[model samples]
Target: MPVIVVEVMPKPELLDPQGKAVAGALHRLGISDISGVRIGKRFEVTVDEVTDAVLAEVTKLADDMFSNSVIEDVVSISVHPAPASA
Candidate 1:
């Protein structure tokens, strides 16, 4: 099987409240070395095969289903082989 990884993040112009909260917490915990933080989303989709059509579909899904177009952007989409069992 193949796995597709999708990354989504809020638009640069928008304010990310969750990320701000995390950054505030980190600063409170004495993590001042890190100036800023922006949290995003990662989605791993398992599929039977990897093909052009599949990739296109995944891209479409990433833009339409996985993220909100008004506020979020689909940052990246990558393909990887599934890990072998131990």
Candidate 2:
């Protein structure tokens, strides 16, 4: 099977409270090298095949269903082949 991966992230101009809290925790733990953090979403959908139509539909789903249009943007969509059996 093929897997379609969709990645979404909050718009750069917006604030991410979850990510901010994580950064604060990191700072408290003495991990000072990192300056910021932004949380995002990743969706993996197993599919029978990959085609133009399928890609188009997935893109629509990403925009309309998987993410909030007002605050998030669909950053990437990629297809990966299934892993080989051991």
TM-score to native of every candidate shown:
0.92, 0.93
lDDT of 1: 0.93
lDDT of 2 by residue, 1-86 (tens): 88999999999899999999999999999998999999999999888889999999999999999999899999999999777771
lDDT (Cα, tens digit) per residue for candidate 1, span 1-86: 78999999999899999999999999999998998889999999988889999999999999989999999999999999866871
For model 2, the run of ten residues with the poorest summed lDDT: 77-86
**Which segments of model 2 are wrong by more than 4 Å?**
84-86
**Which residue pairs collide, candidate 2?**
none
Candidate 2 local lDDT, residue 86: 15
TM-score of 1: 0.92
